[model samples]
Target chain A: MDTQQAAGTSVLPADPGALTPAEARAAFRSGLAVPTAGWSRGFAQANLIIVPRDLAFDVLLFAQRNPKPCPVLGVLDAGETSGPLLAGGDIRTDVPRYTVYRDGQKVDEPTDIRQYWRDDLVTFIVGCSFTFESALREGGISIAHIDQNVNVPMYRTEVRCEPAGSMAGPLVVSMRPVPASQVADAVRITSRYPAVHGAPVHVGNPHELGIADLARPDFGDPVDMPEGHVPVFWACGVTPQAAVMESRPALAIGHAPGHMLITDARDSQYLVP
Target chain B: MDTQQAAGTSVLPADPGALTPAEARAAFRSGLAVPTAGWSRGFAQANLIIVPRDLAFDVLLFAQRNPKPCPVLGVLDAGETSGPLLAGGDIRTDVPRYTVYRDGQKVDEPTDIRQYWRDDLVTFIVGCSFTFESALREGGISIAHIDQNVNVPMYRTEVRCEPAGSMAGPLVVSMRPVPASQVADAVRITSRYPAVHGAPVHVGNPHELGIADLARPDFGDPVDMPEGHVPVFWACGVTPQAAVMESRPALAIGHAPGHMLITDARDSQYLVP
Candidate 1:
């Protein structure tokens, strides 16, 4: 057997776009857990938010009102792991890792959430901006953080999201450093994928959004901003997760930051125009 | 005091668009409950769907999956009829007419649903195509049904909508006769409003949709089709109502055909690109 197969490593091929959604999911299911950044290239990566059925309605409404920050890709019924749109995919084992919360406090980070499974837990897979990064790359744009091999920096902003029931909090955003000349191209390309946070919520001024420093983000590693680069911000999937923290549901479950659920749905399928 | 005042008619002013949404809603509240065809010219008109909380998630998912046929404008929380989105509007007494269905059968058509309103009921305002018809009219296209002073014809097709939980049924569509010259214009104008069941679902052929006759329709009145015109069909809001019938929920309430809930939201608010 080849050394590649012997290691049992799910190292992406040289051309990561060749990876399939099902294959990446299988890798996760088989305990080959890792950050799913380069895997399942064309398929959309989703932010999984699982909550007890009692709080599902509030969270669903929160996602609906703050669609730009929390564009929902698919919502699975309570206790049902498989969905029709996902082509019989399993939610419990499909994601590499999960973060479990109790009363808005992070308590445990589990590789598999099989022990925490309950009949009243509702699962919602929200669209991640990672789905649109591929489009920007295809459009001949360079993402600064990806080049640095790190998670995209995210910040807590002053902009308050539209509140629903008990779910209310400030908006969260992920930053990308784009050359001044490519700002319009970035917006144009991202606008097509509204299902993935649409266009940039803020473009030129980070301070206007209550982001004090680009170097120290609330989450993820910061990237260097070159002379000709301007920071662009898109509504982050973390907004709903942050709101969940503020709302303090009895129990909440989500993917660990940077790890995502790769679905069979292609990014192109979510394009509006 | 004046001819217009003596007639007690809220006739269109020189600029009908100048009419405030509150004035239009007040008109309906005062028993001026007629088909809201020309009221609040540029404001959006929505189809009202109310169901018990037990079936709320199923209905919400159904609308999300079959967005074209059931584009939702606002979904109110269970038991709360007042919403911030609608600007202090009350769902129970706001709409002019409602059709109540019990166990998949029509039971009553009530003007105000205040008596039937329950604490566990959830109200949903699904976007009606009537909002887009005004845009079509503004684009210099004439509507046959408006000229003929009749309801747009609707038919049941063999095409099944994506089911959610107990919600499952054949798709229902509304038909309009468009001149060969204006078909493209209709599609372009309506495509801007995705929240209003944007664009034509099927154009030129009814037989392919399992629709056998143009003159005979399951709902609404059939209008005359001119020789130069072809029938164009749009996904109708009645679809969920039909699905409610197929699902046989304990009780389902919806707006009577042709009557809709006019909202403070402008039709332009729903336009995407």
Candidate 2:
């Protein structure tokens, strides 16, 4: 019974506190795979992107230009498996699942991408929302997605990111409902972790951010918004994937939405302040 | 007469409290053509590198891989005049002097690079030693180069930086003589500013870093190392220029040694801790 088949039949482990990054990776490698959202507690999770060598530079430039939405944590050289500078973690078979994009379309959702991996491909592990979410939880803020057991609602905004080369797209953001009284605490907690989106791009009024409706997100499951709480929007890791898709590269690979690469790096290593 | 001719004939400003970042940039624009070592009081200065679009990504990757030597502050899109994200400052004329490199060789030193500007040129402003120097002074540590009225001693070290595509070279470092009692103070002060080559890469030994002689630097003038003072080496901005030059890009541009860009952004903005 492969991990994918097992995942289809029963609920996978939601609490990754018992597993190491390597163990979590091994489970994925063995096909006991699922989205890595809660798989490895207190460790840094990354948004993965693999592209052909030709488009690597342009994509990197786009990320640099739009740092708030695309904070790059580490990059792997073409054909390289491990980023020694980023805690010596293997790039291959690290994440549980991957989404293969061909010519701007999601073509396949595979458990392991070793078959699709190419020698000319460059890998980028960008900052993910999980890091900041952990920080916010530690600061006494309860995220509704965790409680509701749903994916955080993500939307494509009207805000245009600074373009670089052939890479240009609207900024995509993820929303979390926050109590009005705890808004200041949310900002203070997340601001300390700039590597992972760092601070909210918009705190209130989804319409102001070009998000027409809070309940109708372009991606992910929309969570309930209480009356006393306001919807806060953060620059999403999905922005890069959206940019890559719009650019229409011959081939691109990303983590299957919530599936992330768990790195050996500690979350505290990213706290800038 | 232009500012350069006037600057060569007069004693430069010594008071660190003389000018603000905005005033310094304005002065540079109005022909106060001098190396910005001490002009902008309490402001962090930056090393500028302008490269053709074809090589910008490789250079950026090189910088990211070797952050200890090339801490990037802001990167501007090709042909863009202002970096509103870093500071709303014009890059072309903000630096006091610019060095033009053709096929890895120095061609000209111009006060303004408006004539050499190209539509496909990308600009990168890297953190400079001035940020740390200011912190050291604030902590009551005296820098020998500033005291001796000479350029900081720089050496080409044997340490090979992590290579990126088309950009790989030995790490070049700048040395400052710090008193034995103040070495800790220097580290503590500089560690707070990682955006600037944070902390000393090496302390107390020049031979370990492969420098044969303290008085004879590979680049820049050597300052005296007094008794009970150790030579502290920091990863330098020169590493990127060396990497770029080694790659032999057909066209590359950089700030002249000692000369730097004065941005509207304040130094305090870069203090990480």
Candidate 3:
């Protein structure tokens, strides 16, 4: 089996870590639609949130007020795609697929959002948990979902996010099972990547976060937990989507679950120290 | 001498560190106008900025793009004075003094901005270097300006700030001298407080940063540096004022040089680790 198969990645470049950000973007723009989990390897992949200019401040405030769940990587001006950090990257056609929402309901999924582009649409690229997962793997920690080639399970928690403006929602978290022996190591490695959902919000106590069952998740698929493992949860970037849906904005667009926009920022750049 | 007198602090409450944020702010509103140097000792004091709603985005973007110099503590909504972090603290009269800028000129310095308050005004409370100064003193690090009972010497460096929209100018930096033996410890301690200008940007190399003379400063008073001391530069919060002045916005307001807004956030809350 190739390295992709060995790592249980869906479809990644031959040299995943070696694939530069430009190559990853080119892959997505060329209609190579797939989950961005293993593709850019060492670079951060971002969640996309496009909203009308009228609601832009509320959304930005949501991210600022709830940084743990929605650590914003960059905010592009209205009618603008490329930001100072994500220079030369297109927001409309990036990330392989886009899901448009209206009034808290999913309306349509499109391959590219060129047709929906509006002058008032503002794009916010938020940091994703993938950066921390990579750090976990680097430290010899085995991620259960990655091992099984399944999507990581996510749950809406009892923890309400610190609200901003008219936006407020429960914190959504992605769960991973780690051997009790390696819990401290997991915390240490993930704490180093704060920009990308750094550190676990809860360790072993899913009930405290309002998580009822590991087998049932609000988003993504569940994974089989091996013995001697405890569930660890990190703030998920999918939060802004939930927050937007709650407020029911007339126009909202985001990357389909798993599909993400690849950025040029190195994952190591987000490391705390 | 009392502890405040030995610290060369201007008029402070009998138990300076023991005074609460509310008491300190009430003192200001009651016309107890003095430098907020030693008052409310453990609480983080703030540098205040106010601009019209039209220019709020540009100003906020400046702080977001240049966090080192303008680390935002909290941003209040337009026409709103209280923030989540600065709760119960009035933005208008709580600051001992306010400076009004019109088309880049200082038109008035008011004790309270109640008359100048406009519905379109947005308040931005930025992290001041005073928090880090306290941290330094806690670590047995001597601050020359505080010891001399004078304002910290600030210089306009040749280093260009990261421009955000219409906001752009040379970076304003505050200079503090450290003993050669304590420079590393100083950096280690200060780096813990990223919200307050973090660690020194440049150490021991004023010419490299385009600073000509240590004794001659663009703002504030110069202090004596003893032998074997090296100049360390930290990004100063006054950078926004410099940027605003250069851009010459139609209307702008900020705290007077020595006067600052005391907030409810504890200085220890900003400690990263």
Pairs with backbone N, CA or C atoms under 3 Å apart (clashes), candidate 3 = none
In order, candidate lDDTs are 0.83, 0.80, 0.82
Best by the DockQ measure = 1
Off by over 4 Å in 3: A1-18, A84-87, B1-15
Model 1 alpha-carbon miss at residue A114, Å: 1.7
User: Which stretches in model 1 have alpha-carbon errors above 4 Å?
Assistant: A1-15, B1-18
Task: Output the worst ten-in-a-row residue range by lDDT, candidate 3 chain A.
Answer: A1-10
Per-residue lDDT tens digits for candidate 1, residues A12-37, read: 44644566787667666666566666
- What level of docking quality does candidate 2 show? acceptable
Ranking by DockQ: 1, 2, 3
Determine the backbone clash count of candidate 1.
0
State the local distance difference test value for candidate 2.
0.80
Q: TM-score, each model?
A: 0.92, 0.84, 0.91
